[model samples]
Target: MSAAHDLPTTARPLSPEQRAADLRAMTEGELDVLVIGGGVVGTGAALDAVTRGLRVGLLEARDWAAGTSSGSSKLVHGGLRYLEQLDFGLVREALRERSLILHHLCPHLARPVPFLYPLTHRVWERFYVGSGIALYDTLGGRKGVPGHRHLSRRQALREFPGLRADTLVGAIQYHDGQVDDARHTMFLARTAVHHGALAASSARVTGFLTEAGRVVGARVHDLETGEDLEVRARHVVNAAGVWTDEIQDMAGGRGSFGVRASKGVHVLVPRERIQSSTGLISKTATSVLFLIPWGRHWVIGTTDTDWSLDLAHPAASRADLDYLLEQANRLLAHPLTHDDVVGVYAGLRPLLAGESDATSKLSREHAVVSPVPGLTIVAGGKYTTYRVMARDAVDAAVAELPDAVPSSCTEKVRLVGADGYEADWNRRHRLAAEHGLHVARVEDLLHRHGSLVHEVLALLRADPDLARPLAHAPDHLRAEVVQAVRAEGALHLDDVLARRTRISITVPDRGVEAAEEVAELVAPVLGWDQVRAAREVRAYRERVAAERASQAEPDDSRADAARLVAADLRTGA
Candidate 1:
């Protein structure tokens, strides 16, 4: 392994200055590895490469985790459903990664979340489901969380009072992990930058640079500045998730495997709507439905069906919303209606194409293939095992290099906020007193930013006005808006509301009420004039309106058409 002293001494914020510097540095010299896509895996690959003492550059067409990464069920688990498919190895691997993420890697971002698996059948169901949960706990090595426990129908009712009496005779509670997927992915990108990787968002790879029919680099277009530049790299890793096939075409060759996009839609409702101490996960006919507990809301989802619509904006149709509601209503004592839904989001899963026509049955196993000498394409894996996928991609990219490269050391490298998280959490009350904030607010900051809460606090100290809570979105402080821009690389209003703070999904108006205030809050930091700031607020309102219209549509085609009516701020349609 490379010595720690060889890398940069301290971490740098993903501010505008750092972004401009990184973009210029990418063109000045040839990078050892250039990672396409700023989703979880791509950012992970960049971190892996940089920590291995390799020059790395990571580019994203939009904001980090703007794609499928931001729109996940937000669970880090062993895929308990996969064990029933008899894919024990995949389950074990995922479980191991889950433990690492919850315990060692990003403890602040990822943590234990318990779920109740209600059993309908009186005898056979209990035996089968209990055995599976047992195996799951064992497979994960019982490291980060506690073991599962079986409960009778009466006992289960005590734990989850909202469950219908006829739905299940008993329940088994098990532990998994949950995370804010967008923030976690952003942390990956920032950590990579800290480890000496040139990372930039709003930078799209337009084409591949080839010499002698071998891929050498990429032709990148800066979406923000509208300038085109060449980023040369000895090797490139395509971790483009759902758009993997399109990237292969740009490389002038096709890989051995094909990627299929499976759409998954999730709906967020107020926490009071679900009377459960723990989350609920029940098996559906096609796939499983998860009622994961977020801070002020319960995230219920999802449908597993083939989606060939807009790759960038996967719209959740009225049918999708109804399906989720119907599924959740089956177990709830008081059936939920469309009015209960606070927010809805749709995302595409890059499943590896297989013999089965069902997208749900497609393989979650990732494949790393080199269609060209200098390029490697990695696609199709669950979010929990991103580190393993990233490690494999970096391993493949380094194989072609002449110099002997160091192995990936990311397993031991904590994310930006992991270190001293426990200590900060322990003294959260003191922090709250010092910062002149409530203990609950300080605790929330600790959970979101971990030990890096101090950085956000610094912003509050610098500008006392930033400590005020957002008028419409009270859960998030105004300081978070500035922190998102100054540290987390948020360049647009959507980036802050949708990904950085999740104000877009947690609120009833889908952040429309908070959009103008948020846009104004970050305008100075982003160097946005009155015109630009107004444009951003207008664009955000249009986006919310388009999404609402899309959700009202009955099917995918109509929903996609409705969604496309609003032009993205970055692309302008």
Candidate 2:
């Protein structure tokens, strides 16, 4: 290997200064490709383009993965239920992607998680479900994760003691990949930057820049500074998730294809509530319900229903919460009530609109189209296959270019912190000793930052005060809050408490009690005054209150109304 090939793929830090530099670079010269949206696909598209040696610029209306990307079920499965629908191709494609992520692309952030499917019927259910799981394992090639294994009722109960005895006669255990979706997406954006892509969050595309009849680039408004500029590009790709239709309209009018929004909600409970060694996946009347294990909590979710309400903040209704709780409680020995929920969240999936009346029946398959001469729109896909979607989108976007554009090299590109991760993990105990912390803390940091945990430890070594855990949230060190701003592009307290860390949903207070401390910790890096810090805290508390109020409402209308009560700190609702 050459010296260049031997060099590590370093992750460039995303800071306030870097954001300003990226914004400046976006306006200085015309980019080869300009991508809209900061979700998984958008960031993935940027990574794909930049690695192909294209001059790329990515813009996001809000923080990275603040949308549906962050709010997913956090699974990178092959859509096990899709097998029942006979969508073998989609399942196969997703399974391949899952394998790639688990073993190659993002091993540190994504890992294999086991899911137990409880059989209600003895002979028929076991045969039927067993065949499907076998096909699922076969389709996936069973390279990175484990294959399906059949278990008797006694064995099933041993794996999950909290399950009701009457719920199942036997079970089948299978493996799927799990991730910290928010951090994964953020890392994607950062990796793109490391590979030479200019990206800015809270930068909204207000309008499209046009030539006589051909699309040119985009007119963006910086939400942070309230400055507007025209960013010219050779080709512009819109990867907005559920907001695809809105972007299409901004381009000119609705395109030939349409994207519909399907609402899915999830709730968090204490991990002790489910005494299971493995996760649970059960069939529901409308869709599938997952009781996946989070760090210290269990994430029980989701109801799939057509939604036509606020796109930015989709509210979780009382019915949605009740439906999930009811469905999950059916199989649990001890039923969980509203009081057991520590956090509540809702996200909208951008499904391709077509013949099926049911939103759940909508296609997860994606489409990439050049709506105009210099504009491309890509949407409609599951999070697991974002890389394929991005690769296809870029291929379409660069087809009309005058010069030859290289094919995507992202498949071979390991994400930042992924390189040398295994070796770093093996030395974690030594790292803990060197840093004067417990092995558990070192392991947690390693998982969160992979090889870059050294950078975070450096911060703690400089400021001993940062070594202590946050007052309200003890799981995270105060240095992580500073790291969120200094390295992860966290501009506001909510960014730190919510996306940058899992404090918001994982904590009982939804990070309300930690809001002030976090705000103060990030204030210096973000250049916030004491008054601004106080304001950020107040806004975060109000936002949490509004979310709680919305979760109490019976329907979408009341829920949306309650959620809107707390105006968006950046956009003011």
Best by lDDT: 1
Q: Model 1, 203-253: lDDT tens per residue?
A: 999999999988999999999999999999999999999999999999876
**Lowest-scoring 10 consecutive residues by lDDT in candidate 2?**
1-10
Whole-model lDDT values for every prediction: 0.92, 0.90
Per-model TM-score, in order, reads 0.98, 0.98
Query: Compared to the true structure, candidate 2 yields what TM-score?
Result: 0.98
lDDT of 1 at 168: 89
By TM-score, how accurate is candidate 1? Answer: 0.98
What ranges in model 1 sit over 4 Å off? 1-10
Q: RMSD of candidate 1 to the true fold? A: 3.8
True lDDT of residue 329, candidate 1: 94
